[model samples]
Target: MNTRDAKEILLLYRGTTDDSDPQFCAALDYAKSDPELGQWLREQTKCYDTIRTKLRGIEPPLGLSEKIVRSRPIPFPRIWSRVLQLAAAIVISASVTVLLMKWSERRNHSVAGAQEILVTGEVLDMTCYIAYNLSGPDHAECARVCIRNGLPVGIKAQDGKVYLLSGEPGHSVNAELADYAAKTVTIKGRQSVRDGFAQLQVEEIRKL
Candidate 1:
């Protein structure tokens, strides 16, 4: 399977226990052999772990299930059965909404706390880089084309950290950076990280 296919399959992978499953096994094997895919897989797994930890920390309201059950008759009547189902659905929906709100708040808090950073790295188009591991001087022209076409831009730093680039509202840094594709450059920005993904709100960039 190709990296894209393997990535889709790996998304469903939970842990090493799934190693015995043939489909997951094949995808895992492919990722192991492909450095880019392997790095992506590791980052994905780390994000999953973080989400799981956050979920575990969320506690349900005391006796919520009991309260719901007690509100209905022990032997639910036929007419009330459907009503109970609807109530249960609403309760679940409300719980999920609250959880999502909390998650959003956490993400926003991270962004609010983002610090300014200056990094030197190669300018690259995120699309081809992530999909096919394309980068460097040989891929310069193609990277330029992709960036000009509106694909997301990123930088692969000397330490191997990759940060997705963003610009001020109503502006795109793509036009200015397109010509520098696959070339080393220094960038200054506010770095926001969430779920193992990093993004840079670009303030300054200079080709090195």
Candidate 2:
């Protein structure tokens, strides 16, 4: 299978499933031999682990929820009412922890450079591009609007590959991208991926 197909399949992969499925095995083997793909897999796994940890962390403290609902001989007095309040606090704390974990993930994803490579494609707002399966001049205006509203910008290469343009803490796409949105351009950059997200840290860009 092609890398893209492999990526799509592996995205939904579950660890509990057999590792011997031919297609998945092909993808897994390919990832082992391909640096970029391998890095993507590792990052994807990290993201998955993070999600699992967050979900497990939110599992209410043992018997907390059950106690809240369990029938009792008497209506909860103020002393018993404190248990309900404690449960609320536990939920709130769990929520805050999840938020902090997400913040930490984002912070850890700060984009970095890899080997420089040149690619040609149409600049796009990634979200709309994916949602609408669009490219070229007709979509530029919409792409521009999406980017301005804080959506990611990327290039969908002629080969049907997408390189997300993101970096630093704020973002990588600059005011200069306004002119290129949905327009074909050749760009040179050091590409990098973290948490299965790929990005191009542009060093040069010009209209094709």
Q: What is the clash tally of candidate 1?
A: 0
TM-score of each: 0.47, 0.45
Each candidate: what lDDT?
0.70, 0.61
Return the top candidate by lDDT: 1
lDDT, candidate 2, 30-134, per-residue tens: 778878777766655543444344444556678765676675544667567656754554455334334433433364353453677898988876644554355
| lDDT by residue (tens digit), candidate 1, 71-172 | 974576656865675455435533433443243334333344579999899997775566446689866776776566445788999999998777775577
The alpha-carbon deviation from the true structure for residue 86 of candidate 2, after best TM-score superposition, in angstroms, is 41
Which segments of model 2 are wrong by more than 4 Å?
1-113, 167-171
Per-model clash counts, in order, read 0, 0
